[model samples]
Target: MENISFQTAEVGDALQGSNPAHLYPDIFNQGSIHTYDAAMDQAKQMVLKFLNSQKKPFSGITPNKLAEQFKKIDFDNPLKEYEALFKEVDELYVQHATAFHLPQYIAHLNCPIVIPALAAEVLVSAINSSQDTYDQSAGGTLMERQLINWTAKQIGFSEEADGVFTGGGSQSNLMGLLLARDHFALHKYGHNIKYDGNPLVAHRFRVFVSDKAHFSNQKNASLLGLGEQGVIKVATDERFRMSVDALKDAIQAELELGNIPIAIVATAGTTDFGNIDPIENIAEIAERFGLWLHIDAAYGCGLLLTDKHKHLLNGLERAHSVTIDYHKSFFQPISSSAFIVRHKSLLEIIKHHADYLNPEEQDYEEYPAQINKSITQSTRRFDALKLWFTLRLMGRHKLGGYMDAIIETSKQTAGLIDSDPDFELLGDSDISILVFRYAPTHFSHDTLCDLNQYIKKQLFHAGEVLVASTKVNGKFYLKFTIFNPLTTMNDIRFMLNAIKTYGAGYLQ
Candidate 1:
């Protein structure tokens, strides 16, 4: 085989080389280490440009225009040089990608990633280990296990607690619902749902959640053989927290109607208002009714690390299960989250043993495989490494400080809106998310809705400052989810000014 520069190697060179290994990428066998290094250097540069650039978070590029760019690209033809490919990628993705780290990006639940976690991402991708079995992952498996252990401790779980990392809040929510459905069947009627499938009475199985709860509950119910109607939406208090009084009434009403109350889902951090469902009150009710309680703390899990704010998640320790999204609150990259159970044995409801892969191990402690505990996935990425790296480097207190900062910023921003005559503050939150709108008193409700919607569209199209929009009680409201700890009062003011500027223009 001729010594061909991997970066500049083309199909013509492989034709001359006798070694067939040159025909395909040898990255799997360490054959293209130099090329890998070059690719990393190029990627680092691309991202550095994004970090240093003064450009807007969004490119203000329309879908049709962006689609036109992709439509012309010929994927079939190979680029001989890595530099050429990187340039094309820079134009297509990096230039137009949403920059979450920017201070003006106070929209949605997207968070700015910490530096330590990004370093971990490089290790995760380069290793390319599937966490299904110990043999496949080796040290990576134990790292993920220890991270789970740490997360369980953070949730106040005892020694018997266990969980597995999942893709994100959606998958974690699905696992919680799945376990709720199966565990109810096995314990209540001694029917094994794993093999027996959903029982005949599955139609009567009901899951209770607050009206302000994430929409994933209904979708999860649909996936577990329970239709959307099977999930009940209990009323919430003025702050958007689940009403304890209403929950009791809902359960009694369901029982009277002959519907089985299988589980109760409490939101530790709701999407719209960011208010937490009264978890302690709900947990007590769940215990009295013998209903499984799952806390969806996907957006609020960071409260577990904050000394000042950890009290906000007081009853999470008592819940049967909890969902945590490190990507959202912990400032980690995407796809880093976990679904944890109070009792390790509960995970058996979803466990499966494969002889060829993760064969039955009598002593699970000695030979453990994560695939046995996972549902809806056989091959899992080493996403846990990012969180592990974060803890080892930054420690819990430092990362929690980030959450505290964002929360404090949100409180100040809410007060700003309250004092402003032009903007209307809808409600306060337990965390950092605030739902408000640019409502001038003179405008009718219908006109205000159109004006706020126009403001959101205008800001997005101009790419000046991005803010989220949500409808509250059939009225349009703009939401500011301050997830970036570095986002100062100035950034919030900048976003608000843009909304007002656009709102004023809309009236003209």
Candidate 2:
């Protein structure tokens, strides 16, 4: 909290001089081009300095203290100089920022971005291209399309496949569900959901997913006018993968209750446990029932690049749609993800055209506008550039190698935890996340829960190591999302020791 300090100026002291445009950094100004150059140099140096100086994952600043510091700043007063602005930003953000790139920060699905992606980010921000239409971003549109096609091919889709880059997995999942709902409605009831808004049979629409599937499925269901009840949770096996028999039973149960099973969502990698549902078996059931099958491979999509582990995602090609988050495993920055469909025609449900942008009457084959296949997002960022840069610079095999290392390390960590007498391993994951907690032999269930939670908080406050927390069967447990290839057995051991220390201290 002490790192951030600001001086407040009265409202009258604001706006130093006339022509504020010159005061601020602008890239377009011919005369002030020198200023832009100097600013870029300073920005690059600041980033390098922070990257070099980061010693720990977090700064351990309490929320109350940081909130008080934030109260000192007034938005009306602006720092005109780059140096001052950079200094303030460093104090307020950089120092306290979570260094996810660190091996000690094995808490989330946040993968350390590749250098090429960072370079792409710089170009993305500076160019500020919108990927909605060709006029706005011609090369970007083509690049994005190429990336989508490449991803579809990776998932074993035919040349008829297509997709769009989205903010993240949630948006991709929503797109999948929306397409499924509309497609089902049109085929069964002869109703256009886009024109009529959730057919009369919408209440009967049920989506089947493993109990371990992402929570966004339920939320996306609600957004599609199908309540959370619309999502039927099929039971998982001992490995936490969706049970094929359980899935059939749940679908049959839904049908018995007069509910329509429109789609089945199989998770490629669940957040807490990294468990992947049996996609091949699930796809078989979906096909049997004529239901749309969506593979939520937001976390597990990285396997597509890894020849060693890609067999784990056997039936992805059979899915009607799939979500891929390149940021999670491909080592790209945040918000680099796509929603790909087997057939491009399925995306027509959400298609809308404005004469000013994508004209409805125009020959789309001649002029391909991205908005014709997207929903809600009219002005989209050129996130595909980051993945393009990653693929082109690092190559798929090198990136996939990282995934292999992460999985191996994760398995080793799980074994280490399972072998240890002081800990309890709850569930396993197909990728790299481990769910476990600090527990001594004699500790009661409720007592162990409290102890693990306190350990999580203590670890956070210590700021030496960072880990995630989740609950299983209403009992608290610590989670290790070891997606970073840099994380090793030594780092895992250090984090485990920290947890033990915290647990022992709490009991004492």
Candidate 3:
């Protein structure tokens, strides 16, 4: 046997430019590896240093500043410039950033995404699979299909259910509305309108949603050419769930005004209060009016994972379509969302053909085309992989258990607020979101609002901890979104203490 020869490479020499084989024989034998290693190490170090310096979770940079910074970077010749620029980035950008890793990051609807999902995100990015078609994604496509079926089953939908991975809840909502729009229009006007566009029919298409419903539904309506005026914002009861009587009134009013009530959008997990709209009641109204029903369960969809909280979303099965975001409540990374329809053929609303992309011959007896059934971007990312990997790794039982713990923790926080003389509970917490305001000894509601707002600004600038703020009934309140598994009852107590300490000065 011939003796194998090996060569060692030095990092500093590689940075200064070295032999291709000596630097990275495995990946870039014909190219230099030292430069790449040096670049990656410096990049990693710079990121670490920057993160260490930040006082807040983010740089708070404006779009103009961010755009300017992007333009200033020399992408074509970055190695040398990156080494030098990263040092300045250390001094300027990184030092001002807020670190989310700390126990104090309790603010916003955002959560500390699972580490496994993060790893999976990196893997998916490196591979760059488009899950829109079987041919492009191959095994990846199969993974998404399996995940769709599994999630549908989890949500109590039949085994024949089908769905598409979306960018996020907003996109998911848009896709759902698009389907609803087409379903209603096709049934009324006859034939697909998604491809050819709505045929300016006599009836003015419109949708109904509660005042507590996410703005995404209205936004989706506008994007689909229905216009913001097309969405009828129904009234909510004291608990913020859609009032069934108000919904019926709205539909009747729309009909009286000679408008087409195409769909009714119900919310599960409202942004401010985490309230679940009365889905069953809304479904009954939809059924009565013969309108398509959609549930925007963006933040509350995780309840389906647990039988304990599943009853909160009882009417979800009756929805013609539903939207779920893993990023919000499932401890998954951003952009992990899906839109599911009860009937697979309902997606025919988005059906169309383009010979260049998906040809005719592809539609055979054995393998038919699956391209025309989607409304969003053509090159969809393999977002389902992270979600699939997450379920497989931490089964639904564990996921639900984790959520139950968080919800219980949130209740404890709410209890603490209600008991504290300095704090007042605003609305109730359904999942993990608690909204409350400081109630200083003699301060009025207005004064309390101002005080809580001040405390929020102070805490944000302090960078020691973070919490979100929202307004209810014209009063400002602090929002505790307990998505971080690391966030504990102690953390909640510390936050309450911080608010009292910082807000006491605002007391009358």
* lDDT (tens digit, per residue) of candidate 1 on 1-508: 8985554466546644755545666455456777778788998988888778846889888999899888778878978888998899988988888888888887889999999999989988988899988888989889988988888898899988999999989889999899989999999999898999988999999899999899999999998889999999999999989999999999999999998999999999999988888888999999999999999999999998899999889889999899999999998999899999999998988888877887775566787789988997888899999999899999999988998898899899999999999999988888988988898887777799889899999889898798898887898889998888888898888888888889889978
Ranking, lDDT, top scorer first: 2, 1, 3
Residue 410, candidate 3: C-alpha displacement in angstroms = 0.8
Model 1, position 487: C-alpha lDDT score:
88
What would the TM-scores of all predictions be? 0.95, 0.94, 0.86
lDDT for every model? 0.89, 0.89, 0.77
Instruction: Report the C-alpha lDDT of model 3 over 193-300, residue by residue, as the tens digit.
Output: 755777685238888998978888878878888889989899999888889999999988988988889898898998888889988888898998899898989889
Residue pairs in candidate 2 whose N, alpha carbon or C atoms collide under 3 angstroms: none
Residue 502 miss distance in model 1 (angstroms): 0.7
Q: Write the per-residue lDDT of candidate 2 for residues 173-248, one digit (tens) a residue.
A: 9999999999999999899988989877789999998888899999999988999989999888998888999999
Cα RMSD of all models vs. native, in order, equals 5.2, 8.5, 6.3
Could you tally the backbone clashes for each prediction?
Answer: 0, 0, 8
